[model samples]
Target: MRYIRSIYIFCSIVTSVRSGASELPEERELTTNFSSMSLTKVPEGLTPITTTLDLSYNLLFQLQHSDFRSLSKLKVLILCHNRIQELDIKTFEFNKELSYLDVSNNRLKSVTWFSLAGLRHLDLSFNDFDTLPISVETGNMSHLETLGLSGAKIQKSDFQKIAHLQLNTVLLGLRTLSHYEEGSLPILNTTRLHIVLPVNTNFWVLLHDGIKTSKILEVINIDQKSQFTSYESQQIPILENAKTSILLLNKVDLSWDDLFLIFQLVWHTSVEYFQIQHVTFGGKVYLDHNSFDYSNTVMRTIKLEHVHFRIFNIPQESIYLLFTKMDIENLTISDAQMPHMLFPMYPTRFQYLNFANNILTDDVFKKSIQLPHLKTLILKDNKLETLSLVSHFASNTSLRHLDLSENLLQHENDENCLWPETLVTMNLSFNKFADSVFGCLPRNIQILDLNSNKIQTVPKAITHLTSLRELNLAFNFLTDLPGCSHFRRLLVLNVEMNLILSSSLDFFQSCQEVKTLNAGRNPFRCTCELRDFIQLGKYSEGMMVGWSDSYICEYPLNLKGTQLKDVHLPEISCN
Candidate 1:
C-alpha cells in the first residue's frame, strides 16, 4: 500500500516533467514539504525560488490572489486534503511556471481557470463538482495531459467537451458518484485510466468502456458488500484486442467462482500485472482443480494483500491448488493470515515469494517445499523463534534476500547457523536477539538490519562479517559504539538511541571508511573525548546526520540540553 502511494507521487512528478519542463539539476530544485502541518492559511516567508511546495493535510479554507504572488518558479504545488471551496481565476496568475497542481480531497465545486496555461497535471478528485470544472469554450487547458475528477454525477455530455483532448492518464473517483451514464468513460482518450467504483454503481459498464481506451486500468472497489449479485445480469465484457496490460483491483469481494470468473476475463485479455488488495473471499471453501490451470495466461505477477477467507479455517487444498497453478513469476500474499505455505508438487519457477505478516513457523519447511528457483523470500512479522532451521532450509534453494524482522527470532542455541552461501541481505530487526545473534549470522552477508533488539554489545570475539556494508543497530542497548575492526568495508552505520555516555576518537579512526554515521540521541558526558568527536564531525562533511537535534548533551549539568555542535572546550581542560 505504501508503494502504491509512492507510485502515484512518482507518476505525478514524471507527468509534470514530461509536460515540457526540462529536467533540472538535483541541487537546483528546492522543495518544501509542509504536509500534515495543520495550517489554516499559507505560511509566511516562503522561498521565492522554491520549485516544489507540498501543503497537503492542512486546514486551509480559501486561497487569496496574493497567496502565491512571490513564488514565480514554483512548478509543483500540492494543496490536497484541505477545506478550500473556491479558487479565484487569478489565484495562480503569478505562478506561471506551475506545471503540477493537486487540490484533491477539498471542498471545491467550481474553479475559474484563466491563468493556468502551462499547467500539465491537475488533480481535482474528491471534490463537489457535479460536472467537468473546465469550460471548453474559454478554459486554457490545451497543455493539460492528465486530468482527475471525482464525486460528480457524470453524464455523456460531461466528457463530450474534452473528447478531443488526448490525455496521458485519467483518474476518476467514482466512490462518491451520484449518477453515472453508461458508456460515458470511453469518450475520453487516455493511455491510462484509474477509477474508484462506488458500492452501488454498475461497475461492469465502467470497466467495459474504460478498457477500450486505456492501456493500463486500475479499478478500486469501495464496496464491502459480500455479494456481486447486483451486476450478475450484465455479461462480463471480453476483448480479444484489449490494450490493457496492467490491471489492479483493490477492496474487492467475491466468491471463489466469481474470483475465477475475473481470472477468466483477464485470461483472454493482455493483462500482465494483476494485483488485488483487501479482497474478501466468501462462499464455499472449494476451488475446482480444472479451473486453476493458467497455462496460456501471460500474467507475470499476482500480488494479494490482506486476503480474507470467510471461513475461520483456510482450506489447505484450495491454497495448494491456486498457488501451484498460478505459474506467475512473482507472488506476494502479505498480511493474508496464512499459517503455512505448500508449494507445488513439481518444480516451480517462482523467483520471488513474499508471505510476510503471517503466522508461519519453522514447521512450514518440514514438508520440503520445492521452490528451486526462489531468489527472494520475505517472512517478516511471523511467529518464528529460531533462525537455524530457516537458514538451513533456504540453503537448499537459491534464496538471496530474507527478511525475518518483527518476529520472536533469537539464537536458540550456540550452534553456528548455516545460511545459503548465496544470501546477501538479511533483515532481523525488532526481535529478541542478544549478543549470541552474531554467531548465527551469515558470514558473507552485506546488508544487515538488527535494530530494536536486545543486543547489549558487539563482542570482539565474534567472527566479523567482512562483506558487510550497511549495518543498522539503532534502538539497541549498547553502551559503547561498535568499532569497525569487524566491518572494515562498512559504508553506512546507524547506532543512534543507544545508552552511550561519550564517544571515543579511536572508533572514528577505526571506521574511517564509513561515509554515513548516525550516532545521535546518546547521553554524552561533554568531556574531552566528546569534544574531539564533535570536532571530527565538524571537519568531515556529510558524515554525521542529525547533528543539530539528535546530538544533544544530557550530562555535565551546564551542558545539558546543549547540542554537541555548540559545545567548545579548551586544550587545557583535559590536562
Candidate 2:
C-alpha cells in the first residue's frame, strides 16, 4: 500500500508539471478593488508585469513619465475616477501593443498627439479638456477606431482636423457645447465618421461642406432641440449643401415661420427621409401668401411627427401646398388644435395620419378620413364616446395601432372596434369599461396602460392576453391579483397604490421574467412580508436593486420617508 501511494503522488506531480508546461504562459488579468482604496503611484508589487491594470477609483493626483514604465506589455490601462491633473506624453509612448486607454473623469486640460499615437480605443470622457492641442493630429494615428470625448469642451476646428484623416469608421462625440464654428465638419474621402454632435447645435454648415467635399458622405442626422434664433430667412445656404441623398432632420423644433422657410429650402433637395418635429404656428404673426406657395418646391418623401400647432387658423393656401403638393408618410400631429376645415379632403400620397389630441369629433373624423392607402389611424382624445367612427376604418384592412386613451369609451360598443388581429398596441386608459368588456381585445395587445381608473378588481380573463409584455395598473383600487400567475411574458408590472398584504409577497417571487415591479405607495404589512423583499434585493438583476430610496413602509412599519435599506423593521409591529 505504501509503495502504491508513493507512485500515485509521483504520477500526480508529473501530470501537474506537464500541464503547467503545456499551458501558454501569459500575464494575469489585472483586477483590484481600488474603488474605495487610497493609492498614489500605481500599486505596490505590480512591477515587471505584462498584465492589464485597473487603477480606477483611486485618489491619484499625478503620474510622471516613469510611473508606468514597469508595465511593458500592458494592453488596457483604466485610470478612471482618479484625481489625475497631468499626464506626461512620454509615459504612454511606444506602447504599440496597448489598445484601450480610458482616462475619463480626470482633470486633464490638454492631451498632446504624442501621447495617443499607439492607442486604438481612447476614452477621455468627463474630462475638463477645453481646447485641442494643435500638435494632436488624427492623420498620425493610422490605426485609430473609436474616440470618445463626451462632456469635453471641443470646437469645430477639432472635428475639421479629424475629418482630414483616412479613417473610414470612427466615433466622434461633440455633445457638449454652446457654439460651433462654420466649416468644421470633417471631410472624409473614403471613410465615414459617425459624428455625435450636440443635441442643440445647428450643423447646417457641416452638411453643406460635406456635399462639397466628401464623395462618400451618405448619412446626415440633424435631430436636436434648438429654437430658431434666426427666423424668416431664405434657406439657400442650407439646402444647396446636401451631398447625401438620405438626410434625417428629427425633432427640429422650429417655429411655424422657420419651419416653412426651411421647407421651402429643402423642397427639391431629393432627401429620402426628412423628419420635422415640435413645429408650432407663428400665431398669425407673419401672414405672407408668397411664403406658403409650393409651385416652386416639392417634397417627395417627408415625415412630420409630433408637430405642435398652437394656432388653429391654417390658411387655405398653406394647407393646399402641404397636402396636395408634398408626398408624406407617417404624419403625426399631437397636442395641437386645428380648424375643422383645415382637414385634407383628398391627399395624393399619405399612408399614416395620427391626429392625437385634436379638436375633431367622430362626425368630423368621418368626413376627414379620406386616404385610399391609409394604414394606421391614431385618434386619441377626440372625445370618442362610442365606436361609430371605427366602422369607417374597419374595412380599411391596413389600419393598425389605434390609441383611444383619455377619451369617453363606453362598454357597449367594444365589439365594433375589435376587428383586425394585426393591431399591436391599444391604449384604453382613463375610460370606463364594463365588467367582462375586455374580451373583444385583438390578439396583439402587447402594451396596455390602464392607469388612473375606477377598476377595483382585475378580471381573471385578462390572463388570456398572452402577448402582453408591459401592463400598467397604477392608481387603481385593485385589492387582489389572480390572473397575473399566468402572465409569464410580462416584463414590467406597475401595481402601485394598491392594497396588498404581507402574504402576497410570495406570489411575485417566482415571476421568472418580471424585471421591474413597481409596488410603491401600497399599504403593505411589514413583518415577514418584507423578508422576501429583503432577500430578493440581494439578487443583482432583480427589482429593488435598481431603485435608490423609493420603497417606504406604510402600514405595519409606518416608517414613511425612509429608504428600503435603512428601514428598521424590528421596530415595526402588527399588533
Candidate 3:
C-alpha cells in the first residue's frame, strides 16, 4: 500500500513536469532547506543566488544583519520553531525581493520593523507580543496579503492597526487567550479567518464577530464550556449575516439540540461546505421526522471525522434521515466507530460517500436500496469479509470508484462476482485475496490495486481486462512480474517487495507499453538476465522508480548488497 501511494505521487510529479509547473533546474538549485539541523548559528558560505532558505526548528536564539545579507535574491525565509528572541531591523534590508517571511513559534517579545514593503505573507504567531507587531503607522506592511498573530490577550485596540488592510487570510492563534474584547475580529477586512480559540473564554463573541465579514471561517478547540446555552437568539442573527462559504469546526463539544441549531443556521446561509472533526455529541435525545422537516440546505458537502455520540441512543435511521434532508451531494464520516448504516428511507442526493475505518459488514447493504447517483463509495478498513455482497450492492448504483482496502475480504470460489458496468477504478489492497482474486475482478476496470495481498501469480485468464492501465501487485508472493500480454494498455505496474529472483528479457520486450515500473526490493540473482534488466532501466529514463536504492543484489556471495546500477557483467558472459 505504501508503494501504491508512491506510484500516485510519482504520477502527479510526472503530470506536473508535463504541465511546466515544476521548478526549473536553476530555480531548484537555488532552494536551501536546513530545517531541524540543530545549529546555533546560521551556516556560513550561504549561496549568494539562494532564492529560498529554511532554517526552521533549530537552536539559534538571534539573527544578525550579516546572516542573510549576501543572499540578495532570497524570496522566502522560514525561521519558525527557533529560540530567536529578537530581530534587528536591518536583518532583511539586503534582501529587497523577499516576499514571504515566517518567524512563528519564537521567543520574540518585539521586532523592530524592517523595510518589508515587498512582503506579501508574514507570520508572527506564537510569539510574546501582547499587541500586534504591525501597526497602521507601519507603512512597510502596505502590500501584505496575509498575517498571523497570537498572544495571551486580545482586545479591540490590538487590531486597530491593521483594520484598513484588505488581506486574504488572518490566522489568530488565541489558545492561551485570557481576555478578548467584543467586536475585535470584525474590524479586519479579510476573506478567510482561521482562529484557534482558547479553551476557556467567551467563544460566542469571537465567533459572532469572526463570521460577520469573512468568506471562510475555521474555528478550532471549542470545548464543553463554550457549547451553546441560552444564547440561541444571539447566535441566529450572527449566522444569518454570515457570508462564509466554508465553515470548519474542530475539537468541539455540543449537544443534540445545539448540533441541530447549527445545521439549521448554516442551511439558510451561503455556506456550501461544512466540516466537523473531533466533536462529541452528548444528551439522550431521540429525534423524530419533525426534527428534519426544514427545507433543503445550500450545503453541498458535509464531513465529520473522529466524532463521538456520548450517552446518546438515537436510532441509526434518524441519523441517516438528518443528512438525507440536508441534500448534501458529498458526505464523509470516517473513524467514528460506526457499526452499521441502515438504508435511508428516502432517496438522497449523495454522489460520494466515504465510510472508512469502521466495523461495517456485508449486512450494511442487506437492506440497501439503489443509490442512482452515487459515483464513489469508500468502505476501506471495515469488517467486510464478503466481496459478492458489495458487488451486488454496487451493480445497482452508478459507482465508478470503489475502495475496499484494509479489510478482511477474500475470494469465495463458489460465488461468482459481478461488478457495476460503470465502475472504472477499484482499490482492493491490504486484504486477504489470493491468485483466484483476478478471475472475479471487473473486466472493464481501468485501475486495479491489489497490493498487500496473498496472491502468488497472475493467471493467464486476466487478459480479459484489456482496459487496465495501472496495476499494483506489490507486497505479494509473486516470483516474477506479470506479463503485459494480460493487460495490453497497462502503463504503470508495481511489483516491489516480492520474491522474484531474476528479470527476464521477455518481460521488457512484452511490456513495452509500460511507461512506469516499480520492481525494486526484490532479491535478485546477479546474473546476465539481471544485468540486462538493469541496462534497460538505465536507458529508459523515468520508466523505473526507486531504481538503485530499492534495487539491490541479495544473491551470489560476492555480489550481495550491490545495487543493480553498479553490477558488472562482461558481454562474453551474457552471450
lDDT of each: 0.77, 0.54, 0.77
Instruction: Check candidate 1 and list the clashing pairs.
Output: none
The order of the candidates by TM-score, greatest first, is: 3, 1, 2
TM-score against native, each model: 0.71, 0.54, 0.75
- What CA RMSD would you report for each candidate? 7.3, 14.7, 7.1
Best by lDDT: 3
Stretches of candidate 3 off by over 4 Å are 1-135, 138-140, 150-161, 175-184, 232-235, 283-290, 293-296, 502-512, 524-575
User: What would the TM-score be for candidate 1 when compared with the true structure?
Assistant: 0.71
* Model 3 weakest lDDT span, ten residues long: 1-10
Instruction: Work out how many backbone clashes candidate 3 has.
Output: 0
The candidate with the higher TM-score, 1 or 3, is 3
lDDT of 2 by residue, 138-214 (tens): 55666666554543344565666666455544433443555545555534443333334555566555455544443
- For model 3, how does the per-residue alpha-carbon lDDT over 382-443 read when each residue is reduced to its tens digit? 99998878888888788899999999999876777878788999999999999888868887
Q: Please identify model 1 stretches exceeding 4 Å from their true place.
A: 1-144, 147-164, 175-187, 222-238, 285-290, 312-317, 502-510, 525-535, 538-542, 552-575
lDDT of 1 by residue, 51-115 (tens): 98888889999998778899998988888889999866578878999998888878888887675
RMSD of 2: 14.7
For candidate 3, what is the lDDT? 0.77
